[model samples]
Target: MMDASVDFSKEMEALTKDLVGIRSVNGTAGEREVAEFILRWLRSFPYFTTHPERAFAQEIPGDGLGRENVFAYVHGTKEAGTGPRKTLVWHGHIDTVGTEDFGALEPWANDPDALLEKLLAEPDLPDAVREDLATGDWMPGRGACDMKSGDAVFLVLLTYLSEHTDAFSGTIVLSLNCVEENEHTGILHGLDVLDELKEREGLEYLFAINNDYICPLYDGDPHRYLYAGAVGKLLPCVYIHGCETHVGQCFEGFDASVAAAEVVRRINYNTALCDGYRGEYTLPPSVLKLADLKPAYNVQTAQEAWTYFNYFVHAASVADILAVLKGIVKDSMDEIAGRIDAEAEKYAKLAQQPVVPPNFQPEVMSYDELVAAVREKRAAAEAKETALDDELAAMAHKLRAKGRDLREISLAIVRELVRELHPTRPLAILFFAAPYCPANTLRQEVAGEKKLYDQLESLVSSFGEETGEQYKILQFFPSLSDSSYLKIDDTPESVATLYQNLPGGKTVSPVPTERIRSLSIPAVDFGCYGKDAHKWTERMYKPYTFGVLPKLILKAVAEFL
Candidate 1:
């Protein structure tokens, strides 16, 4: 696929390094800077300058950081008897995760040349990392593997396509998105751009190629792989409120932390609660955040406690997941209820007086129930002035204006609700939070979907055979991506699970569920081969990722077109 005159390997290497040199950590100024640089690179070509409208930046609304998604499309002139042009979307995330993991090398993290030298000389380095450095087959730095290298692939391909537009008979759309490390804010907003573009240009969507990275599961894992679909993710947060009483009257009030701890104990790393599809099982849910809601330390047992877990969605529906979570909460409450009464009884026997044990009863409910309770309470109060929904929306907007991240805003809204409703203590309230990504997998039963996927599998196999490299088409990508926005298997109505309950869902990077499902483009992730992505020792395999993968990508897209 590479032209003899063009130094394809050198082009890839230079482009990758140039992208990595910029410290575009997610949510930083560097993120926007990198996007601007991409814009300049695209418009640098005479072709783009002539057709400036073809390449432009799409601002992601409500980011609060002013980040943008860079888009450039090239049209192929292959004679095809069709009403609308066939289009292929090639997308990559340009923003990288943070550099705090770099430790003392932080100052040079973005300077790959200096970081490489520092890593090679560092003592107590892992044997594998040291060996890879010695071989000089790896390019080490933050974001080098996770995806700036992949962005380089998209940039070069877009350039190649722009130059050779007449050789193929389809359109190619290159999307460089931001904020994949956190909320996937960039691609979520970019979904709007794609929908409008498809309608205005009358282009038929085919599929997307996500140029993320592929790392081994274990040492020396030799197979190169691609993903036909990606797993979904949801953050189910549990907030608990407890009765407050002085230390002298220990049995009079129970601590909310007890129930919170129980929730974590029952849910964290519990494989029985995991979701499975075909033979693929998602990693068990684990707590991403667990903390009390107190502003500061005090003598009184915590008034409220909060925790949230990372739940991967596979074959299970949202309702299926909520039922399991509700069951866990109920079981946790029952066990905690028993403990409270038993402990109170023990204390009474030890003290030996006319003592009255609190024997606090634990209560569990979903966020939806909490909202309903608040509404009922408002109706009883007969405030008659403000609608409950409108008031909550205003409050959420005020919080966003203060610059709190979506997670904090989410918790804050719940806290306000708790205060207004004054829910009974030893209480657990469960709800979804911002940045919910629904899980998606291709349904081969759909018309033409099977043929498209089979064609992709064959292309991967041929590439592997030609290069004498092993490749496997995995069921799930085993990582999070913006690809979730490409196609959705769930009904559009199913979106209410998050929007109706997640605090500030409308403002904090809401998933464009209907738009995504309507687009419904099949997606395949062919990533740059690398190891230890998001780790300090992250490295990309220069020979294959830079030299060979470009040809493979070109061949696959050309075959599809």
Candidate 2:
């Protein structure tokens, strides 16, 4: 039970409002302020103050973006004399996406109350959404729903556990991490913290709980989900290198954007990729970001263009994802080749002139193959030289250490390599970007894995029986989460093969696959209820989010511990 003095609703509301107002948007001066505030808040508690070692902060060094991760824990009586005590981790990311114009309340950037008032008054706000706001039931801002609410919930629960340690019998870990909006580096920090904690206290991790926002089923539906796994995300960028032509002779050369657009047409919102598991879980590929890779306004038929997609996967591995992306590139390029050939035929007929033969077929090559070719060429050129430069070695060290700049450098190298190796052929290179988050689930193939999931189901069922409320075990979390960082058993050889096959593999973020797999802990995403996650209309339903969700968390902790 919670302390009678603590007003859970009011505290949550105040915390949520303050947190949402803080601009912890990814890539800017991100998460540092909010994380410092959390550390200070943790110290305010008598328990943490006395055991200050229990709370700590870590910096993810190579992030280059200056993001930090925070962690704290409340120890139960049993933890002091632990042989191997169970631990429950409450993890939440403190980062939000950009604060684009918040529609009518754009001016209320610093004032959350003004923003909430405007949200309540806006005529365009849907009735179902507005009605919920009227009943002490709204939080509006960038991070309000897409998870400051979850942070508030975790804080309250952690505080409660601290105040009433006798109610539970194991450690409750609080991880208020950064960079979930982008790289998911905070969870990596959490893994480090867990390792240290395990070494110090000899504790065993039981489950990780990520209280992300869970959107309602529909307008009026109040039911929420308890997700066992998260869908993986891979952003595969397709670079089209075309032959430039003067504007007057535009039909003489193909535009790179034409080929890029065709790729988008074949991929964007395509339902065939949305394969379902158990005929219920599905995540289709969507275009998160795309643009013509040109600078300034001079139009020379765009010699090069690129577009990346928000490709999602449920049961697929890196190899599976690469195969699908390769297939899409091939099919789109084939169609583009036919279109270009048709245009060439039409141009020849109209002008009765010698039309430039279109090299519509695009050459595709993996990053490894390109790198190997570049190495061979460089070796031959260097064979005549006797000495290596010290400056080049220093530059190599810098590049490896600060990998954030590798993508552009790799692209430049690939372009040069292509010019030297296959001067006449146009290239359409498909490759992954930074931050590869692989999908993970509690597989029941092993007896231990089966037991854990079965126990969770039984606990949820027990809670449902007590409250007469229905609960569901969601097969996959619809959104990407930090839980993807938790390691699983995957072959290093297989991961290496896939990595080598990726077109820009050398530039992609080096995901420590084996390290991640070694620390794989099962996780559950039981979060707040909201809608319009990344939009101006984003708001968390207060009644279910602030009220019932906390109780569910408390119940789960009690049962699991």
Candidate 3:
């Protein structure tokens, strides 16, 4: 048996610092180095053996740099009278999002000594210290929350099991992959190699636990949650066509950027056909962009102009829903193009003009099941909300004001629920588009549709659980419309700050006071970094781990293999 005196805090701090010290920034060629470090660490353990030639060095497109994936395994002892039941796989990715300061790897600014000092100096350090200031309740650092901490946690658990081998019930395998932040190519490659190993050994795996974002001890909860579903992503690029002309010219024709803006406006406003969930299908636009390319002097020149627009569609949507969205775009484009043509003809009567045509293409997620999973999650969230209010009121007492405490408590419960719910969403989406015009300004007078902000409000209001509770829809744009437009910077630090700020005057639902007793962990401010893996926009939460990890682990252990 292991010593109870062993300080897990010291070990965790050291491991965190060591991990942060390694520069495994994505798009950099340092993955091999970091992989080797992990290999060495795992090899030092007597219970684990590195898989020969299983460490793969791969070069990705565009970056022209080599990355690596590492694998290892440990045999499980058979029961006194029964053969080994099955093999369990624990997977983690070793790559991190890139930052301008690639050299930040040396001498982690957030070190153990620093953390210990802070922890000990705190006025109220509970006997069972469950939170880290550096990360608050969430995992901190570049890859800390993403999967590196997961790697460390896996190692810690394995090491503990090794010392107390009798505690484990089955065989376990460790798979550390690279390039998850890129295209998950390393994972695909690793799986292929595993297949080859299985063929050679005539063995099969019964269960796989992806420690991608596993938080073992976030909250004090004792439940372990297992994930059996995954959501896919769909990124489609929409292009608009218009006319370009000199700024001084009396251009009466369409501007490509302006036309694209109208398209976005319509997308944000028109909701009669798009609002509410249809069957198991739901559609929400994740990101929208409007871009322009032209000479500074000839911005108004009567030449073909174009701009690209991107959208992140949820995986739960059906083919029919996508077709409907496309049809909407098509109709909008036709109207815009017609107006531009008429304006061009009118301008031609007085001066010279050019022709423009609207164009768009669709890029979909590779898997359909992913879409289904996301839809199911939305349905579950709705159901949970329906049941939450009554549950909260039951726990409230005379000392606390029912409404105020209930709101706070409900908000906390919902926050926890969202964390559990988000992982069920798709990983990412890819979009494809092409240019079709210069000044894509297709402005024809069409009846204005209800804005998206209003539609979202209606959807939230339909919950009808409480009143005076505010709701706001936050829109993320990849690029700025102009200097005044807010741009989403996908860095962890920036995301953390944004989550803390809740800018754009948006109001989030508050937690109900009565439901606070049900929380696995105390509520803290947190941010989300969904499955936008390869967009260089991946983020880590600084406070989620303390409040969410333990509950998730306990749930997984109790309910799932």
Candidate 4:
């Protein structure tokens, strides 16, 4: 049994401070150090030392910075005749955003006490924010709330389970991943490793509970949520090609940057594309990356420009998202064409020269169409070149093997194939980029879906009914999360078709559709409540996050497991 005399608050606070002090900033040198620290800490436990196979670390390499996903599990003692025990996965990310402009407080980065005092005493801090900090109810640090606090919560749960092995009927599996803020590579690697553990141990996962941080809905009152699904993310990059002209005759040619700007203005923060409403929640589209293609400083107008959007969706299909984006491009193009025609008329009237035919309305082409056109043109000249067909087939095969999206490879192939085939240099084209997370929702009318939903919902609602706590079933997590990999749909073939018909469909890869379909599992986000995550003043509300949330999660685990 767990030691009842132990002060849970102090223990959790110490663990959170230790984790936050490690400075496991993604893409930095400290990530490996933090992973090593976690491994060492896990090993220090007597249970882990006696059964070392129960806990270990798996290294996942990123762009330049490699990371590690730590895992620990405790199996149940129920008899073999009763069937296998269900697993409750507790997932948390260890990586945090970089610390920028820490100012004089940089010295206290490793000392939460000093940092907390500094933050509370800072003159520039807001009165409301400062008052909250002054109450000593918040732990202020870069990753303190965003969410090493959640990690500490899971650690405490694991520790308690180790002492009281019979407290639950099933197993408790914990996964601490990295790179969630940027690439989500950590979760990808963690899931694969988790599968290996499950197969090795002959365990069945009942649910994956991710402890990611959630922002409050109001200032004083924290609106607690139970996310039934994660929002899907898409990065759509558009390349605009324009005719370059000298500054003396700039009005005669279209500027690619201008077109790029118009596209940004049209799509950035446009709520029309946010049609993936489930219940009362929806995540609108926003801008993540935007840039214009310009070679060195010169007097000539730019010929090419590119921009990528941070498009998010839930419950919306690929075709719908594409159609909306295409409409935006068409509108921007028409407006730009009209503006250029009016400018040409003015220039012609002032200079007494014949009006330059305002024939610069660009045609928008999808990445697949562009690549196919290039391939057709190539095959016409050389009848024996079967490389393009082989390449596309190979891409599909690789996607099946890798379980990654096809956007990056497709973008590379399309850029290579179509760069030389652009007869119309001044046209706009849209392509998908790297990193695609498919959205998933639990709301379904199908019998199989409903059965699974009822099983989990019944378990969750029992706790509410017993405690008389009214819990709102949130539509979407409203953020990109690894839980997307856990969802499966009945119409998988249709889903695959939609994916293949997206803007860069030819290059898009299978999204673990097969795995999710075969082993579809329900996931929930029971993360800590916090304010200002990914910001300098990030902090977690101690009372609810540390005290109440764990008990609530424990209730679900007890009922389901």
RMSD of each: 2.0, 3.5, 21.8, 3.9
Q: Give lDDT tens digits, candidate 2, residues 1-561.
A: 544334477788788888887888887675888888888888888888899988878877765666789889887873355377778888889999876667557667435577778877788888866776677566667888989989998987787788888877778888888988876767765677777786786667887888898886765564667888777666766777877777887766767888888889998888887755555555567776556667877858888877777877666566666677778887887777778778877888898977665756666655565556656776877655422233333444455566534445444445555665653556777766655777776766768767878887887787777766577887678788887777443356656755664434433465666666766677789888787888887778776677777877887777777
Highest-TM-score candidate:
1
Evaluation by TM-score, superior candidate among 2 and 4: 4
Expressed as tens digits, the lDDT of each residue in 380-497 for candidate 1 is 8886756777877888889889888788888888888989888665777888887787777665676677787788888988888988988888767888988887988766555776
What does the lDDT come to for candidate 4? 0.72
* Tens digits of per-residue lDDT for model 3, 445-467: 21211232343234434322232
The C-alpha stretches of model 2 lying farther than 4 A from their native spots are 1-7, 62-66, 78-82, 109-112, 353-360, 375-410, 489-494, 501-508
Instruction: Please give the clash total of every predicted structure, in order.
Output: 1, 3, 68, 2
TM-score, per-candidate, Cα-based: 0.95, 0.89, 0.51, 0.89
Candidate 4 steric clashes? 2
Look at candidate 1 and give me any clashing residue pairs: 232-439
* Whole-structure CA lDDT of model 2: 0.73
